[model samples]
Target: MIGKKKTDATMILSSEDTRLGPSFVEREEVYTPCYCEENVWKLFERLARDEDEWYAVVISNPSRTAVVLEQRAGSAENGGLVIWDYHVIAFRAIGGKADLVLDLDTRLSFPTPASTYFSRTFLPLDLLRQQFGEVFLKVVEAKQYVREFSSDRSHMRLPDGRWQSPPPDYPCILAPDGVGRFEEQMSITSEDVARRREARGWGTVLTLEEFRDRFL
Candidate 1:
């Protein structure tokens, strides 16, 4: 589940350097703002499905007000930190070489070094105020996520049936065999990483620190 796993794809060390990762994923071509989950779905479907070398990273809070920093879309408020009810990204772990992160909204590189990304993206717990809310992480195997995750874009709709934000041009992502398991997958949220060592149907729930120690 963690970085030691291997994949059949070339271990090129950097997706950006190669311009195309496994399955020829071009980040800019596939990315859309506010559709991080779907963007990551395509990434894993292309690059990480054959093996365990990649994982989907979900960051959010029980309050639906997770705070993150240095996002390109962030405003001047909170020193340019952005508040996302939830956000998703793809993580690739290459042994010995630095691991990488693929965050569509970050000011950082498309596939940034794991260590740099964390240091620049996350606010320290000590500095975090209650108003900003706290964030937890879910790190799931890309294979598992691609197979189990589905979204109808219901979360983006207004009661009048108009989209709060424009939907992706691509059709909604559906679970394999049409299982429709998005909520079931999101239900595996928790920060007590040690207590939940065994991976659940979704993945392991981890605090930011636990996520770093385990996945970073």
Candidate 2:
């Protein structure tokens, strides 16, 4: 029952569904580990540009390992191929029972349960440690990750100051207005999380298995 949702559940899950609380817009992309960092940062830049109050975030396994999700075999209903390496998602507390997790690339509906999102993406913590050593998985919430994607300085520059690549196309996955609404939700501060982390004694390094057990 943890991952399984009833058929009727799907009907109620939409980008505009109030039951899921609020929703966020996400850009569509062919994800790959090689470019996931840039992609996620780009997404943050997009969100920040559209909504100044939104935070830029990156959540990943301690190892920063990348996993492939092929559309041919693992497409979300939206037909997106996600190669999640340090996957990016948005979060804001909406006065609901819990925080809303907006992961538009998933097979499940947008704004699904955080537990469901983690279950689908992150590998087991124990396995990660075995392969990558005592790395601590972390959540990085930065006040300024990037400028607006449409800004003149938006694209990453090369050592010579040349543009790295063309700016990303407007997000094609969901409406921008819907995604920006989350910026108004209660803030989830780093200090708040740190206090909980200290009380829980998870240490700085958290393995994938441990994270799954604790969060999922």
Candidate 3:
């Protein structure tokens, strides 16, 4: 079941850039399968053991939001055991085979008007490429992650001049090292996010869909 919510159209600005990032909600639409959680965890655990390759697990929220568990092999840049990002929608897990009610799509649905509201300005994948550059794409490709997130997704300006997941969320996980050794660069405090936006100098707000079409 998808969900629909009102679009306030209020966006968070970046301190490093004038562009408005993705919008935030007081509460996110997220759910996990009670029965499959353990099995899913096991699958992830097994994938994590390999130090020469990368693996991931994904989970999607009703509103096109996806969570990714990115595990990568160690590298000269990092020690082994690194888990970069955990909530990447583009690689989230949706139920395909399970015992009870085998469908994850039903449990996940948009919230009506909210879906319509976003549809008017949905973000495209191309924009993400432009904003983040090859570094981001390389990781996705390296992990062989699937596009579980929406085919169209938006990005937020991070404190570092780079674009990243919006505040109150961990979008990308950078694990130069193998699983168990990871570093998070995109997360920020609400105060920090606000401060960064002011630092960058912003003029207006744009929806994910709007931004993708305009700049990306």
Candidate 4:
């Protein structure tokens, strides 16, 4: 859920460095597969408190049917597909320019253009409704809608059998110093998510290409 933070007059108009945007300098400190909603919301809350232009966003496909493109360090072999579940990020409107998506968990530079973010990730309207509910979708502002679907990280668990409620300092699946492919390490895939949905008697599973054509 998003919480409004009051910002001072001076902080409201302050412009961030466009070169790097508002990304964290120490990238190693950022972790993944933790309490994504809570951590992302906390980061956005801090930014909103400091700058009035910044706002927190919680995006997800509760049906967990959407697929996103994930680029790693290598060439074609390094790239793979990932399913989009309940994820959170921050946003800021750039006058006359594409909006910014601040997703700390992603490898992309923080405050990347919204167009770029959407190109990599696909969130279908049908999936969004399943997660956020119908009434929330009627609203134009995402901030207003997210509050109704706020995630409780207290019950979140990691593959290593750890509770995400009390987030650890470094809750990443792959250590910063480790050398391994993220997809291999995480075993994240659209097929797996689809299987789970099918087992639950959900609708037909859509392929990645189909999802891209229909949603993107």
> Which of the two candidates, 2 or 3, achieves a greater lDDT against the reference?
2
What does the lDDT read for residue 119 in candidate 1?
90
Worst 10 residues of 2 by lDDT: 1-10
Model 1 segments beyond 4 Å from truth?
1-24, 48-52, 76-79, 96-98, 129-131, 177-179, 187-196
Q: For residues 1-216, could you state the per-residue lDDT of candidate 4 as single tens digits? A: 111011111112225534323533332333234345445544543343343344443333334333444422113453434444434555555452336666555555554666676566544547635754211100012333223233323235567877634454543333344433322211224454446323222122334334334323
Q: Per lDDT, what order, best first?
A: 1, 4, 2, 3
Q: How do the residues 33-74 of candidate 2 rate in per-residue lDDT, one tens digit apiece?
A: 223334555555444434223332344332334342312224
- Decreasing TM-score order of the candidates: 1, 4, 2, 3
Between prediction 3 and prediction 4, the one with superior lDDT is 4
Model 1 worst lDDT window (10 residues): 1-10
Residue lDDT tens for model 3, 12-35: 333422111232111122223221
Query: Distance (Å) between predicted and true CA of 139, model 4?
Result: 9.1
Candidate 4 wrong stretches, greater than 4 Å: 1-32, 71-80, 95-98, 123-152, 157-166, 169-216
TM-score of 2: 0.42
Clashing pairs in 1: none
For all predicted structures, in order, the TM-scores are 0.80, 0.42, 0.19, 0.46
Best by TM-score: 1
Clashes of each: 0, 5, 40, 0
Q: Candidate 4: minimum summed lDDT over ten consecutive residues — where? A: 2-11
RMSD of 4: 13.2
